[model samples]
Target: MKNTLSPSFSRRSFIKTSALAGGGMLIGFNLFQACKPEAKPPVDISQLNFNDFNAFIKIADNGMVTIFSPNPEIGQGVKTSMPMIIAEELDVSWDNVHVVQGALDTKNFTRQVAGGSQSIRFGWESLRQTGATARQMLINAAAAKWGVDASSCKTENGTIINANGDKLSYGEVVKEAAALEVPENVTLKDPKDFNIIGTDASNVDIDKIITGKPLFGLDYKEEGMAYAVVLRPPAFGKKLESYDDAATKAISGVQDVVRFGDKVAVLAKDTWTAMKGKKALEATWTSDSKLENTEAHDKILTDLLNGKEFKTMRADGDVKKAFAAADQVIERTYESPFLPHNCMEPMNFFADVTEEKVRLVGPIQTPAGTARRVAELLEREAEDVSVEMTRMGGGFGRRLYGDFALEAAEISKLAKRPVKVVYSREDDMTAGIYRPSIKYRISASVKDGKITGYHLKEASINSNMYGLIPNFFPAGAIENYQVDVAAYDSKITTGAWRAPYTNFLSFAEQSFFDELAEILEVDRIKLRLDLLQKVKGTTDERIQYSPERLENVIKVAVEKSGWGNAKEGVYQGFSAYYCHNTHVAEVAEVELENDVPVVKKVTCIVDCGIVVNPLGAKNQIEGGVIDGVGHAMYGDLSFKDGEPQSKNFDKYRLIRINETPIVETHFIENGLSPTGLGEPTLPPAGAAVANAIKAAKGIRLYKQPFIKHMKAKAPLG
Candidate 1:
């Protein structure tokens, strides 16, 4: 069966057209072109003009096709996969396609942000249309030349073939295609006929990344650009009172010291000098609010949970009545500490601000929004600012906020010269914007050996879970289900980190489910299957997960992991979750050595719809699993007097290479449009390992950094 492009293009909606000076064609589709009336084609074929399109495809006389990807590249492989989508419909050989990053152009592009792993999901259809439109136009041109019906001509690897054996390369017909009217309808290839989509393709930037070819933000440099390092307040609740840079002025390579609002910056010829000058300056700080500590945070969150000030996120049925009639009630509390993004390339941005315009170049997840913010801060029109995005070392939700870029813009405006702000490891760690410490209290009611009611309460430092998360798993499966949220506002800063709320919440809920299975004396896998069976035909539109897809992944994980069939000395744990529009299931295998449980391997099953670039998809799944397991085992961040306690890797703990377990990944291909893959596989990893440890050693763990609990239970020699 074949599928035609939907919505049928409007006559007023045309692919913005242009022609290369060297006799080639340029065709593109603006995401918002449907809203505007199409302009008439230019009379001059050699100089056709269109400036409104965002994503573009250019055919060169040398048979090369260039694709412009309009989303930020945050190590999520969009730079590679997006172009593949376009090339698949373009009917071009993969070897002749080249990918380039498109600059920030809010006027032409839509959804230039990269957070939430939605770049591919949002751009899939539009990108395919861009290619299919270009290919159709090329075929029309060749058909006109051969005096045959356009439908009778077919394209194969950048060449158009007529039914009578006449042929023309794309480059040869591009000139005539530029003068043809944009087709109102174009046919899209069936998934079964796809050659470049389902097949594996290496990352477009793999060679540059491996060869260290100045691809990351930290590698960006400009002539006569001054390096600046800012000195922020030591604690979250404190503000700078005064600063004296008399000694800093004497340092070699030092240019100037400036202050902006509550922070001071030292500009020098190089990053090392800027850092050295920053250390030499003296500063005083004053408290703007009460200093907070980890102990205080714990008490505040616990009080919030016990208080009656929670806002109900979702309520499915009469939870009170269900709980009252239940024969048994089970409850537990889970705690997780704050975490840092810890990107391999620390925070950095380059800004060149002047009277007329502002230029920014760096690794930013939200390029369009950041440019707007810079314009607002500088009191300039949005059109006066431009942003260029570089490949990021890692984002993990850290680069979503543009605070670093703002600092660079402010400093550059003050100095009247281009400036690049760099952060040392300690600066990156202590400057705040961390994952909020969170606590989850879950309660479930059991009646006649079956679950009846489910209630969950979330308490965090600054913000609560997003509004849509409560409608995820278990919302439709359980009849009497309720979700509540509470928060404590603090001077400490916090934002999204990796999977956000679900990272810890999944562990809490999944671990609690394991306890429920134990109490009911039912097979854990069967218990989940039974729950999913109840939601087969749910009418709730608010429910965000697919029961059928989730069940399939769970079953696949069970079979691949050989659940309940591990060899001697090996125990297994299972967890299944859905988030970021993807369904994932994970199983952890554990073994005990000298009374210490060690995780040996993890089997992960994922259903993220169509797999674009299998090699890149596997990397995302494996990386997410390792990050989730490592953070659950050893990651922790504490605060003392409103200041982060761990300033560097020496004080903070991460998963060591030797401790990392083998990760086995499996994907369920349903041939649907691709969903997010970067963060979906991460949320279930912690719970799988925690449950496995419980089976291996008969201990239930509720706190993160599971190593702490293991050490407390260890016996003296």
Candidate 2:
């Protein structure tokens, strides 16, 4: 595949070059251009002496290159892949290039977030420009020395060669390149000429990660730092009324107990002592709102879906008329329970707050926003606070909230010393920001064996789906389409979890389409292909998905999975979805054992444009698929009187190694800019499994944690 899009350099992007203190060349460039009108051109590189750009590439006198990646890394492989983009355009040898995580600089960097799986997508052009511009400067420097036109010089493996067959190492021209002017524009390599990209590369930190290095947040420590454990309200809709920490202070190794807001933190010399101190403290809580339960939530959501009040997100045609004229109508409701992030490393952060400055170190997904929030909480300037990011064991949107970081800062300020706040597995699960429980009611009016009218109503806890989601998929496929949303705001905190609303929505919609296919007496894959054909060349600007790309992935999945030709006793399910700027399709193969459906394999096909690193890309795809399968099969979180019923793995169920299926991954090698892969592969797994189960056993599941339904069936043995 070859990329057809031409690289367009932003007029506002500026580059600066300087000499390193140890005799090296440093090139810094801003990948994001300012939104304002074009500013004056940057000063000549000969006069610049500071490093103020968003990303940097430093070449040592020994010809070794170090590229700084300026994004939060949450195990999505941006730390390894982002630098590949820069190194690819720099024309540097992969063996000599080093990658490092850059600190948060709000003024210099933009979109340093890690949630959207967009690190590579958004940085593709600017990062390439940064490297290409530097390569041009080096070529110009060598050309000047050789007394030849810059066009006559070519670079290969970090060496510049002129028409005369003479070569000079990049180290030989480092000083001269540092003196040249920053090029306003540079030509990028065509996709066909890519050497470093579209190839397998090992993770930059794999050696350290495998050898038990101190790379995660929990491994961070500082001299004189106190370990703190906080006791929060036991349940939602409750507040701290009073507390007595006399017993906590009496425990050995206990330093002090400090109260901030509605929570109390027990600071001690070590984590065990802090935990012991927290357990010894006596506290009383009072409920300010009705105690919520899973049953109550279900009732409320169902009521909201049945009610008349709803915010119409998107309405294309007269759905009422279409429904009235239909020969048959199909309606089904899909429900899911709240879910905790369950990050492998729990939540922990180290903070040192003094009168002059505040320092924070943690494995956070949103460093810039967290820094700003922390500064605001402490009534200090944002610039006065600095954040250092560590590699996270697992984020899955859990690390996006900095409540743990905030608690560390508050405790450090009150204790008059540095402190690290750590959460027990119970604290992490019970008091965590959760994926809101939701119910989706979908209805379609059929006439002449075709879906004529489609209506989808969503009721969730707290927030609703993003405004643009209604424009995806079926919105354009059906002429009479309508989407409405309602929410029941609760005291329980809820926010982004992996793919957000689409995670469950994909399963619901995809399963509904499967059922729809059964009623229409049509092939499941053919139904989706025909609907996508209706969305081709749509002029609707609000539609964010590409029908052509989706169709391609679906076709690839069908071909790779051998959709209709599985071996005897093997049943298959298919699902396709578009989210996070990527299109994905999955086929799940299941086998029956004693009347229970067991997933055996999953085939995933993705259209995420160019693959930066095949090795890392496959890791993400397989991980996403397995995660999706596990959550859909056995993951569930219930509540009783506003308290989570499952806080630890003892009661909570996670997919074990024995239960995991073999995942076969494939990608459509389109030459377009890459899209996110971390999340796009997850949303479709649930539906694929559900559909496969339905094929294996003549039963349909309309709720999550499909295990419950599977258990209800009588065993054939």
The C-alpha lDDT values of all candidates are: 0.84, 0.84
| Model 2 C-alpha RMSD to native | 6.8
Which regions of candidate 2 deviate over 4 angstroms?
1-12, 15-54, 466-468, 713-717
Residue-level error in angstroms, candidate 1, position 222: 0.6
Clashes of each: 0, 0
TM-score (all chains, Cα) for each model? 0.94, 0.93
Best by TM-score: 1
lDDT (0-100) at residue 223 of candidate 1?
97
> lDDT by residue for model 2 over 344-432, one digit each (tens)?
99999999999999999988888888999999999999989998878888899999888899999888889999999999999999996
All candidates: CA RMSD in angstroms? 6.4, 6.8
Give me the runs in candidate 1 sitting further than 4 Å from their true place. Answer: 6-54, 465-468, 715-717
